[model samples]
Target: MPHPERNPFVFSDARFRKFIGSVAAIGAAALVLVGCSPSTDQGGTFADDGCTSVVVATSSEKVNLMEDLGAAFKDSAEHKGLEKCATVHAVNVASGKAAQYLSDSTTEWALGADTAPSVWSPASTVWTNRVASIAGDKVVAGAESFAKTPVVFGMPESMAKALGYPGKPISLKQIHDLIANPDGWGAAGKSMWGSFKIAKTNPNSSTTGMSMLLMQAYAASGKAQDLTVADVKAAEEFSRVFESGAIHYGDTTGKVLQNLADRTSGKGSSYVSAIALEETSLYNYNIGNPDSHTVQPGETLTPPDEKLVAVYPSEGSMWSDNPAVVLDAKWVTPEQKTASAAFVKFLHTKKAQELLPKYGFRPTDDSVDVSKYLNADVGVDPKQPAVTLPQPEPEVVSAAIDQWAAIRKPSAILQLIDISGSMDESIGDGRTRLDGAIEGSTATLGQIRPTDEIGVWAFTTGLSSNIDGTRVNGIGVVRPFGVLGGDKEGLQSDIEDLANSQRAGTPLYDSISSAYDYMKTHAEAGRINAIVVLSDGEDTDSATRLDTLIQKINADQKEGGNDKPVRIFAIAYSKAADVESLEKLARASGGQVFDATDPAKITETFQSVMNNF
Candidate 1:
């Protein structure tokens, strides 16, 4: 476990410091990979270059641990009989994004800088299998695991105790029943806790989300493994029931954890009752922080006032075996392959493997003790993960994730887009900010369920007439709230027309209150009722105060009845936009905010936000 050998490149060394601070680019050719350079010496080797680089791409969650391991491997004098010097460089990327690069050859993942990875360490093997299916013979099967962790439900201590925590084991069925219960948490004698809300990540984009959906299917069939297409189809009712309580669906579990930790005490219901995330996330949350991006070395994390305890569902759960895979792509050189294998072997060493426990992960190396990390004080049970679910066929896993959006509850949404003067500003290419929003809106409309009801309202300082010359509150009603099944065309046209219209001043507060009240009154059951606000400016004309609006939303959300919950999804449209206030507004009703500050990302951001539905 001691330092292998003094790092050849010290912190004080210019080359080491420069390489460590390099940023990984997105949507462009990022030079973060290592490629072999031709030898000039008589032995056909470039030993003078110090070592050949074996660049690795690690899943976001494992970035911190992998960074430590990579540094150690690079500094090690000898690793598993490898004779040549080898440098290991680690970069963090989303598992899904990494899989996309491996599956497709034309993808310029990281050009010029580092190139394609010699090794890929995703959070789970699910991604490995997926990439293999797409790339055929290009992927090596059964990669070695360096760290082990499982998906778990993280709930507030008070909420877990209400469901019989220490004495009784909680089941997935029990959680689903709570979601289906008319009185929500009140059914468990906690009316003030309001309705049961679940914060989950997007299945199409997040590993935790994929595992959560699979677990629900397995739980529904009363089986822990061998989930078939039939089993997934049959679980529709269960999936629907469970997803009904979902208040937010983000791209990462870390964001959800941060939200829970933020509103833990007096505002218990501001975020969610529970989050379906990695056990590692729960461990991190209880230790006072949620995001590893902000974690500083030697900084002691302060525990939250209300700790989050991990509840291993009685049904079963999947382990995220952080697998280190050496891809068999054409870009991988023989020297790079050897170096990659050496690094993998080095990862199994006690020195590297022992770091897992400190990061809330179960070390894959059996020699490491796990008892201390899984104690009650850390919000986990040492012996409670009794069932380990099997990884279904890759096809089945894909089907289960693909079917989730279709089977989950429908959404009834009111899109309140800003048409204030700021929207008239150009976003380049002879297009205005409003033009970008219109493009995004049109694309998103195509993805919503046909049976769902949707409406569009354009707001500015003063009210205006509709395309039909009809006026309401001096504002324009582009498309009246109605079923998408019959009015898709009209709605699409109205959204386009909003691009051409312009007005003065941004009446954010009044527009939000009006939309919230309207949606609440016309809220549909068995559907996600929401008010989505797309604004590029702060409140300029409104009688309602921000605090008053927040109180109103919180009260409305907790009023408990047969009516569906109404959430506010705010999009801060530009850099100068007031995101802080928008985020507060969104979280007030247990909703989430999406950033569309960059004009180039407008379409993708809008489409991504719809993943919550």
Candidate 2:
């Protein structure tokens, strides 16, 4: 039990500096994997007359800053007479993306935003430490705070008044209590001393959003003043409010920010505000439409706080660690590696550091005046400075996220698998699509317990169970669309049994619709509900057809599943597989699609289904 150095692909290698020096492309690739990708075609690999280019891998937010930052480095690249240059292809590589990238050995460096790569950007110190831990004992890497602002509780002025505005720092205890005992808040609707709402991400993604939940868990459980599993379960009290079945799946920082402007979303709700939100988002929100319907105000708990104040959870909060490292892949050159290092150094220079104000970033240099950037820049009040956070061992934290997942809420799921023709093709290593499907299905089953429910439906010869159709037999029955039934144990048996009895052809369409039908029938809000569909090929057999089911799924994602508008995630198996169709199905259900042959990646696919449910 010392923290395993295995680095769960999401993040690997405790030592930061040396790793980058070893692989230039690794970092850049990590960015891509995490959904923080920068576009290419800006510059080519090797420039004329010995100039070379290396990939700067990192998250989109950091990648967004690359244009200006990268360009500035371009000037230095020319000035230093260095033959190589660095171009950032902002791969959307987040922590989860990092694991994939490292496993595959792509990209140059893994650049992140917070000091601690795992959580939100509490302050410069927190970001620095996590990256250091990620870099481990040897690498001498330092976090350069380019810009920063405190995370403010963006509540209406009225809500602030209800919570005792302008009082000492908001007590985390109050927030935890609200989540732990939402019923209490209901009785005291006018409760003013301290008002709070739950802020969370799906835990599978959104490091910062997860941070908010963890802090609360620690406070609620009170197992230790320092962060621990006990504290996390206690903080899970926030999920209690969700048990009412209110929280939506996969609402990250961006969505939460949008919800903040809408006051009607009563009681426990709000995002930790940042300075550099999407420029166009704020512009549009402030502009309002012709009817000005969006430009309405509600009884604010605290009138929109003018100056930014990052409320460090009184019990303590977590920080985000965004590190800029180089992957140093075979494609990289020594010149490119040096350029990457110089680029990082440039970010700390006066010109780049000055950007902290306008961009809503807090400067790492203490000497600079953060206040000057207040209104003129992002309107982030200069009063706040970067906060320092404790760096808990990564292993303990990983376990915390799991415990958080458990105590939060139970999930209900329906597996809508496509039994089409292409499942017949041989994947690499002599495995068929169905073989992989069975592997994934088997793995998914082992993870589920009684609290979780799963159902199975195999489509090929007919809509009934793949085996002999026995009414309510241990195996689930297939219907018109792709739907299944029963608890975890029951569902697992059905899926495994269905795998055993699958015919040569895959009935993709029928499977999808049937699975969807189950969700509609059993639709319950508190239960995390979804239907994960997999098709090795196209929909050959389906009385209803895949197109019709897709349209219905699309309509549902935009509008919440009233009874159970199931979120659908899909896995496109094999090389010739119809990824487009699979992707379309997933998007309709607010899920994403995956290519089965590529690295046999089920991380995103499996994660999407589990997290959404």
Candidate 3:
């Protein structure tokens, strides 16, 4: 049941009160499978065929859990009541991607299932509510939450202790105070910890990150709920300050959690000190599933040596009621709907509900004790998270998402493009490797804010190289660094020219080292400094050693004490590209490595890398 007191602010608002009253009336009735029907009664009678298969589309975070539940359904005897063997097929789709599929049923990825999905279980009800608002009665008309978890700061136990956590609830205001201080955690006697690197998903792409944004809005307004457009506007400065501490913004929290788990010590080696995550993820981490990837059948989890503790903010936080919605799409048959309902019922069963605690989730069934799973050993307090922030209307969430890019930390990025002879090869789409790289990269420039400092570099071995008196191994720079405000067109022209240039051997090593040196020499304060390199070939003609270049890059990063370290993002362009070396370069600078091996994904992959800003 939705907490009435915790959500009072949303209910009390005049607009929301009216909206909820009308929506609740629709939700109270079980809608039919046929799309856009005025009647809310979903009751249907169908002859049991003795066997039915239902496809369930789930969010990435719950993929493993859903798989386990699916296996359980297949082996359960309680399902005999339907006189049908219900085959539950679970597909893991990211929340934002699933939202898109719901909007456009013709989406290519959704077609992978033998039949259309009968149910859609995103990580949070926020998504269920979103689909309802967009598609109206034609989409998810009703949903049942199976498990409950709240958003919390997942940090190493030692760091939490230093910040007075567990003993005291850490507030966002306290976090902001630390971010504002240049000394970072060093002000609190932990100088080696360096800057307070926080990790969060891009709000537009993630449920957990979206909840974090709401928390920030409430913190700025000093309210537990009813976040307004005015509140979002007022919170812009605070949001920027808070966002400045983010080392990287991924599409999901798994990457951040995995990075934290990789280094058990949770010191300078770890990319992030704290990450915004659902308690389920922290639970999974403590149990040794760092990546939280899909789990195969009969697999047993091996707990990790390092544990991540949840720090519920004193200001307030949001609870994710992981709702499973039986989608009211045209493809859902009466038999399938009945099967889906059975599966939902099975999830609430005592046996199935008992599995929730073992996976670090609070079961929705009242019979299961929340205390059994919520304990300090796994890094959560059974009695805490006393406050649940009220959710604003969906429109308010949309507004906050739109405002993020404007208030996010500015970036100083240098994109290094490789124009080797191999780039002239075809990618089978009537587009050459160079052409795809140019077109894809040019499109990404538009997403960069005008205030950001940007530049373009195209490197090939024998092209009036910039090795004059500089380093003995400097590769040619097609275009130098320029501010995007006035040089956007010029940079685009340079990118296009790369496609038309006469190809030469790739100077991968020298070009990378030279670009790194250029950015390091011109590193700007108060902005994220980064280098994005797209290469389709290995070093064919370069005097620089890969190890030596990596050493210089790592050494230069250490020179700037607490100055935002310059990160390198590498895109391994094709099958023949050297991914292992690129991964090394990216990891050396605390950045990410993106794969664009499929020619078709070049544009999308480049855009994904831009999300880091």
Candidate 4:
């Protein structure tokens, strides 16, 4: 690049040097443009040519792979001797979230599993073509198979045997029969009851959720005959079977995997449900197995009896191929795009794809077999790559997901705030525990719909426990305070007010106990009632012991009582914050215990709870 001091006319004419120079400047600019027109190098760096970085937005599940894949192309210990190639960033997200972020100009590349991601690869061509119709710009079909594995119906082997697995093949109808066994309907169609249950991933978050919905639709419409919409709608038994089984249905496939893992962990109960989930996640445990044998990396064994039976489902089965997507519109550059492509390529490479097997996911590469990466005892049998995968129209698929979302049960949430003195201490963002509690509670309310009644309760003062004759639980007071009628602005305001004006007390027992009673008394029948309590201190004030509260809550729930037996969640603000208490309370009510010492991260914890709900 060069800057000219004077134009040709300015140097030749002394009279009108300024004017001549201005005129000459135009001439010089035209000459420079002509010279730079693909003839000469007019730019300083080739990076300016727009081939640097490429942003690929993707499902959050792929974020790990994306980062790992990106690192491999750099030639350090992880990527030794490799060129400074394009970077790959996987924009992982919740199930439909990628689709929503894709239309925005910020994310030029969208990655995801199934119809959500527009980039074509694996079995994504059809999805890409369809999204392009509405998304406008056409996407390039990149070459590579990052991970390929069949989606299977996870269940205990004993349960599978009862469903005609050992001898006769179990059809979709049979699976339905097993789930609806305790619940039967002649008009809906039932050959026999296998006495098993059924569950599914949340249609809102997991890719398996998408797969499950489409499968149900196909099965309902009689995919055996390439079911039509009319056929699906006319089949009254369809909704019946789908809704009957929900033993461990979760917001994400990972959550479902944890549910399965937790059940058969040690002397644990097993779910006999025909839960639809990805084989990949089934073997990847956040916590290792009983023996070093199955816990070894790249090792996992099937139970002495293979509880998991792959049911292609008499109808079409769909696979989830999540893609990477970028959302920062202003920041998505060519460099990021290149990085994304490189990342995809790296993932498809032999070394990386091999990691899929340990997680029970089969790789797409032909050079290597999954058995090497799997502990045969606990691994899924994904042979011949899902020989028959049917692709239904996206509209049909979307409609099925929509229907599932609608039919799902509503959530009754209770926010149990710890208003003890310890909450007065400031936790990040310059906000005290009380302030954090209020902020988190109010924000959580904003995320939920009004149909979802979120109630807030605080535990403090002499009402902390069941002392003497009081019905309260521990001193860690957590109860309902603010309640909004469904989703509304006024309701939001009321929740905010409750958060601000909450009375400080050390009697956590009173709040949690009363809130449970309130929910039990007021909750709409059939909703999943749950209470979430956050505390920064211990229970020094509860008059009632934890045992009494648990006993009462359980008894009341078993037999209808005022508290109606609600799920109680315990969230400790820190490690010193009485983990034992939270765990006991949470276990009693089937609620989870979360350690949330930082109020700034309260939103994340709240969101996690919301997802599970």
Candidate 5:
């Protein structure tokens, strides 16, 4: 039932031959799980019933599908034959985060499921390979493809037509050239479309971003496979050119797609010309479900007026062979392993494979037809991805990530912290809301390169002047913008001083408007120019109205044809925080808002926001 010809994991390189061989052995075993009655246990532990409890930690995109399959498998004769031996739980975990958790022994696996996973199925084997390289071979012994989707450039239908898509394949080199050209879409004779902007996620945190990085490096080396460390080094300049076109980076692609969908609804020009996404993601976007979350029954789906079509690179692209990997960890019991294998076998059945296409995924079992779902109606081609770039050695993949860090666009960030009276309220563990925020902000400094430009501002009503004797306003410049390499210590000190600087009343509107204007005036080219706002309450003192501030942000975003748009990334720090206003401000400026209502999670939320830079 397996389609060898359609399989993209076939490796010709000697380095990965053994790995591929092991994968085949695993696949042949049909190792998976079968569902049973739901457990009424806490902390991801199995109820002390006679059945084995198998936990499958999967990437977020496949959680619903896996859950459905598990539910269906519960009633099968195969499960009944085993006397309901196993109860399976599918939990959502980001691929990159899962790899990080497995790599670090001390890190607790508190990702939704409180217990460590018996099996880990990330989006691609790339993650499994990374885990193996860092945590040792014993961590991820082997993995097999469960479903497949190729990385692609999701572009508006009109834009794809202009680039000769469908009629001709678009190569990565062509995309790089377009990104480097100051003329933007003018090179394609569509000046009205404006500059060529792209939305790319942080490679360290996203599978699509990792695939994009690898493919771009391979394209630069002029090789279809067998990429080397030298090739990645040689492609630094090329990578920089392509990265320069990015409007911003995030931990996930959902934000990018959601932004595009929002623009479509508003009947405005798309925020970005293209976004790096999986083929399934493009299909979902075409159908107006850009976030690709499982649509609930009775939910009305509205297709976007402007659909996004997939452009498989002629130079060759990569596939996310959603590999189901049974972890070889001490935590996994033999019984759980057996149940895991059974679950994977159930996934390969015709019934299970048939459901994959309905969700915009290609079945790993080639016998399952995909033509019905992957068609022009959904902005995808069933026969696509004729050529897949070979998987490089794990070392090469690691080196590419390092090279990306060096060549990726730097950021210019101005952080605004609310020092209102409410910030003094205790969150828990003897820490105030301000204390948690400061901790998160301080930690964020280490996440960015020293070459980045950084500054800080503290705001509260009646704040007339700063430590630097700056002019009067509702806010004070705790630290002026400077190269982070030189001002790291001073910035840290300024942030610490904020704990003692709490004052009465929040001047939210005035602070954001002033910060926005300042950032726009000093916006740097070849970097992410933006403001980061962390607030714990609504505006209590400000001359500027919310509507007036939004209008100013909109006007600035549209100015100079948006050549240097300054984005505003806001974090609502507590339930009392004004989330709706923050969302509007962030959306207007081409940035996204983060919800941190639970102050205890501020540290995690802050790091996520920093990934944008």
Candidate 6:
């Protein structure tokens, strides 16, 4: 089907070239990237000058695409023809967070600016459905898909070939069978590769994860459409079995793909055998841009030695139909609404649709051929995923989400905090770095499941007494591992008390090593074992070397025959924190490092880290 002819505005080749040439001159002045802030300035810089500004809050993966489109729209004659010239501004916001912001008017909208979005375009329509369900249908209007990509299991080329991928129809049931087999890859005669570990994101926090969840339900029900609440319940066991094979859950697919690419460089394929992510992500990984960030001009990409192939589940899969929705909120003015509609319409034009394939997305315009980009060279088959699953009703989706919380893999986590003297230094608002971290950690406790095991430990040089009065060196257990259901209140209080215990030097190296040893020793078999380290600075005093700690972590995370996997998630809490060292520790353990260098973002950062479980 050809793109709908809704907007009469059309640009000829000469006019398009003229518009493109003028973009460099006006793009900078017109585009305003908004971040999280509490102030309410719905109209941006253009508002003061009698110009309409349409603020578009979009998912990170498509920020670059939206920014480019925004710039082009700004330069278009249609925009100039408006009674009041308009500027289209694009801001990067995660899909899940955007839903939260939209559902609650009291919530702060942007990070750097006070402006709320006039238009919201998340990676999938499911998010819009969620917002409409929570805030009513009036809140989300005119949701039109502009681009699409199906969710698929991305496996290493060798592994996919072993399963007869292109020749044999691989289904979710087949993958589940492999995971259920105690022999793992041994079932396929590849005894060298141990357990078949899979990587996925937390459904509550990711689009691909949410889509994967829905697909799993459909696969379990043996239907592609009209999935019911009873169907979700009946599939509970099937979903649980599939989830048990997960290596670990995260907030984004980028980290998993990046780690997989890094492992292929030298560390080998011991990290994860397969990952459930969008087809575009697999294409990006095959082209050596796992994170999927826009490649700049003059940038050279080095493809990984072990490229991944897209495995479209024979049971049927769901597509992330990137949709642009014009919100009908009180904050969105009439002029802004008109401008937003124009921009969304422009996104479907030939010029805009032509750029979609270049960015690893399938264009909504059927006339635009995607064969060149989605071909075997990038490890994706353009003709596949022959089956497309429909989105379930909002009620069914809500039920699935609730059911997922009960069946998802539980966690065994240790929170390691730095109470060094430097943490006492003020970071505006008369609050110290330790205060921010404490507040963030306390809030994170609410997000944890009751069945998960959690604990807290504070570290500073010469700390001899723990909360329980046990003697220790540099590290003191504020609370030992216990089920969150019974220990949450006490854990929150202990984490809060950490702010008053700041003293002495930072024994970062020794403390981390100690935490790793403890968690590894107590690692649970059916749960994700992890250590979350939040430190404000580098090691001021420690006998352990960085290389030595890295070697220890790598040895335990060996490619074959390792059962206990305790990942170490590091958080650089302030500008003074040693990001490089923390990154090395995280990478060594097949984990991720989060930067909370701006102390104020600690709460948000902490929540993101907890999503790994």
The segments of candidate 1 whose C-alpha lies over 4 angstroms from its true place after superposition are: 1-59, 77-92, 100-106, 110-119, 139-142, 186-194, 264-271, 291-302, 327-342, 424-431, 462-474, 486-490, 541-543, 557-563
Q: What would the TM-scores of all predictions be?
A: 0.82, 0.62, 0.83, 0.67, 0.88, 0.89
Q: Where does the lowest 10-residue lDDT sum fall in candidate 2?
A: 290-299
Quantify all predictions' global Cα lDDT against the true fold: 0.73, 0.44, 0.73, 0.48, 0.78, 0.78
lDDT of 6: 0.78
Model 5, position 432: C-alpha lDDT score: 94
User: What ordering of candidates by TM-score runs from best to worst?
Assistant: 6, 5, 3, 1, 4, 2
What digit string (tens of lDDT, one per residue) describes model 2 on residues 480-580? 22223334454545555554554555556656765676576776645556676776666555476667887786556444213344666677765566787
Worst 10 residues of 1 by lDDT: 35-44
Candidate 3: residue 564 lDDT (0-100): 60
Candidate 5 on 1-613: residue-level lDDT in tens? 1111111211123523332233223213322222123322113454444566667787656755666666656655446556346656666567887888888862455543345678788899999888888889877886878799999998887788889977989988888988888888899998776788888889898999888999999899999988999999998898898889888898888877877777624323437888899998887666556676544433444566677888999888899988887787767778777777777767777777876875678998898888766787677888888788988898888888888788888899999999989999999999999999999999878767889888888899878664334475888778887788866777778898888884789889989988887888788878899899999988889889999998888777665447778999999999999999998889888899987988888987898899899
Best by TM-score: 6
What does each candidate score in C-alpha RMSD? 8.6, 12.2, 11.6, 17.8, 9.0, 6.7
In model 5, the clashing pairs are 31-341, 32-340, 32-341, 32-342, 32-343, 32-344, 33-342, 33-343, 33-344
TM-score of 5: 0.88
Runs with alpha carbons beyond 4 Å of true place in candidate 5: 1-53, 85-87, 112-115, 264-270, 330-335, 466-472
Give one clash count per candidate, in the order shown. Answer: 8, 112, 1, 68, 9, 7
Cα lDDT of candidate 5 equals 0.78
* Better lDDT candidate (1, 2): 1
